[model samples]
Target: MRLHPVVSLALTGLVALATGARAESWNSVTVSWTAPGDDGMTGVASAFDLRYSTSPITAASFGSATRWTSTPAPAAPGTTQSVTVTGLLPSTTYYFAIETADEVPNWSSISNVVSRTTSPMPDAVRPAPLTVAVTSVTDSSASLGWTAVGDDSLNGTVSSYDIRYSTSPITATSWSGATQVTGEPLPAAPGTPQSCTVRGLSREVTYFFAARAVDDAGNLSALSNVPSVTTLDSMPPGPITNLSVGFVWLGWHSSLAIRPRSAEARGR
Candidate 1:
């Protein structure tokens, strides 16, 4: 016995109502639905049509709304099927639905609709300036230290630091010529002092050093106060040993001669 047209239509509506969607992030959603029965009464669904909109989703609204199709189609009947939808706006609500179609090309009504709001995007801002100083000095290098700065409004974490130095006195207006020092490790955590050594400098030269903080988003802070440090001078050579002074008369002039003990024996 064949069922009436009205009965078959009612069953198809029930199957379509089983579909649902979930918001995964600021730009994505996951759609899922229960498989419909394989029997001709409800028909065998060979594929799924997914649609989304900022407004309430209906069969008519789907025409101009964003659309996506299920690839490889849904599995055999009674299996839970799902598909992820992406590129949606964040912090906004979106409505989604799924429509099933049989091999005979008969399309079912729109499935149950669901809505979700995505998370907001991160804030992009620069961090505050850091305080720097020279802690130690050597013949050809200097060790520097500074206090770490917090991220912009604490929206992000501190990443690293940029150290710069110059032989001339460093000031906010004259820092462009300051050479950047490399091979310095990332600064310590916020509220702590970070240290690094600058090498390959000229001995006995006075240098001005400064530093800046960087956040994870690549934001750079203002330059810190410049501290001046002078490298140590070179050591002096040893003095000669066993020296002697003698006076000699040549006519009306008297001359004094200096000689080493080892040279006196050779001269004799």
Candidate 2:
């Protein structure tokens, strides 16, 4: 179609401006950091596209890139925020990218790529040390009492206490088979007690006692130190004393069934 020169130029200019406006122009740049632990920190990037990879990177190449649309926005740029990623493989290295998405461009360039390795978790903490006291003791059994341990995770809140006992002494290794005597529940108020008597132990046999605190999350504290006690052992009556020979003979004469004999004869 034939058109005037001004008209053609005006159309071209409009197209160019539209294309440029759609492509680049968001130039705000910022960086922030976060520490998962004492070991490392993560940089929260802004105004830049981020791509992460376990291996060395090249332009626009990321082993894994932050899915900004799906992932939550990183905290304010140039600031560090602490976060712990749970269920991460132990001792594995992970790479991350921080980037900004400019409305003008199809995809923005990544600003900085930071990599960090997760720490290996230690064995779960043993139930906190607790004191289980014996309130009463009988010839055959004893009554025990205990208080719950404070959970540090919940700001010193306690969820429950596991009351364990064994006729044998309680040790970390030996307590595996110990009977769980009581499970004292800690309501929101907390500070509830657990008391129960243990029976079926042999007289004079020492039994050990211990308790463990379990938070609502099922984290168990270390087993407390073993406390032990022995059952009562009552002695038998004393032996008979010496008596007159005449009285003994008279008693024997009166009742043949009740007759008494000399020690040597009886022994023979």
Candidate 3:
């Protein structure tokens, strides 16, 4: 209640910088990956992962490198570990680093060693596997067609086709409301011929069709495995009789079989 020793040491150094950013240190030490550069483009995030340096200072002098795992792993607060360091040693000059356990040791400030020089793994041009076909199905409409995309590896053309559906056979991670067919680059070799006919839909209902082919820098080919359709009842219902009711002694006691020859005409 009296005196300023330099204003109480500047309020005790602002309460030790807000308690050291809240007792920082979530510890995992090492377990991360990053190698961004795929250029497939569809949502383009190019994955990432590769760390072994910069922490509280200890462990990892440098010995192992090359780890990227994201077959279907990358979605959450978003950063569920990544690894894609394939055979790296081409031009030798590596010194990668990127640590982040979401919050531990509070690491995420050492990504400036991106000096890459490995070029000899770019012969993986896959773009030929989209031959879907349903042709027709009426009840509300649906006539999708596809058979184009014949290995356009470098010529690079295709550009559109990703129509998925699911009435519940399971295998649709969420398309929100998928139905996008736009492929028309043909001249033979399964490269030119596309069609679409999807309307209202809902009569006898029972649908499931599939298609996939996107190459113009969208790169998405591995989802043409759910072809099915059953929608045609526009007006079908005419054939069902025999109501029955006594009807001639139930149709002659079920086609007659009750005979005793009337015991000689029942004793005359």
Candidate 4:
């Protein structure tokens, strides 16, 4: 005997976006279901309404649950459908349910609720400390280079770089007080080389710099080994300004002498 009246709403790894998501990069959780006929699955359903939440989803609370609009159009009865819910925190569980309607706008009962939990730190790992070094320096700027590290120990590119510098050494305890560099280069693939130039530094001063990586899941990496460089001394002394001569003599002698220059001389 074969019977398919349409009643299968559940969570399957496969994903398709309803309207909003970053599925292209996230390859994460998705909801799968067979169109329900409680309202009208034997006939072509007009639309689908998918909703989800952090807690258990039920018929009584369906109205307040978050709705995922722009859901895919329903196929004939028994055809499976799915959607990828995006922008969720790591290590958290989510509940989902769906309903359908006919051309007359008669909606079906909320399907069975399904649940999924996002992965926390992928593989329970953190990125290795990045290796950064000051490559060059001038009177007012310094260039740095480092080998890029992955989000989870060289597995995936990190989401961002936390680069900072200070007159003293940079460390986890003092990271917040260090001056954060603006326009840090975006993270590259693990083992790839990356660099950035920090400008507007004071001449003849030494600066210690460090960096760390952050993953999309919000996990932070260890602080990098600190490297430092002293900027070149200020530009050569300006052209000689006061060059007049001076002489010390007894009052008895009537002799004309040049006055010693006491203050910086201006271009005359």
What is the C-alpha lDDT profile of model 4 across 1-268, one tens digit per residue?
2222334587776343322333322224688887755344456677788888888988899889988875788877777887777776666788888877776666677788888777552334668788898888999999999998988787998899988999998889999999999999888889999999999999999899998888885667899999999999968878988889999876676689898765566433
Better model by lDDT: candidate 1 vs candidate 4: 4
Compared with the true structure, what per-residue lDDT tens digits does model 2 show for residues 1-268? 2111100000000011112213211221122333121111223222333343446444446535433233334343334432222333445565655434322322333434555554443323344556678887767877877655566532466667677778777777877789886434452323446676777667877888887777654667777767788888866778778754653434334444666899999999
Write model 3 residue lDDT over 1-268, tens digit each, in one string.
Answer: 2111100000000011112223211221222333222221112232233443232211253224433343333233223343333334332333445422221112233344433333322223556666577888888877877756644652556656667655644244654455543443342345566677777777787877676666644555666666778888879678779766663433333566776767779889
Candidates' C-alpha lDDT: 0.69, 0.50, 0.45, 0.78
For model 4, the superposed segments whose C-alpha errors exceed 4 Å read 1-124, 244-268
Off by over 4 Å in 1: 1-56, 59-122, 153-156, 171-176, 237-243, 247-268
Our model 1 lands, by Cα RMSD against the true structure, at 14.7
Worst 10 residues of 3 by lDDT: 6-15
Tens digits of per-residue lDDT for model 1, 168-241: 98777877788999997866657776788999999989999988778765667877888999999877878989
Give the TM-score (vs. native) of candidate 4. Answer: 0.49
The local lDDT score (0 to 100) that residue 110 gets in candidate 2 is 41
**Alpha-carbon deviation at 257 in model 3, angstroms:** 62
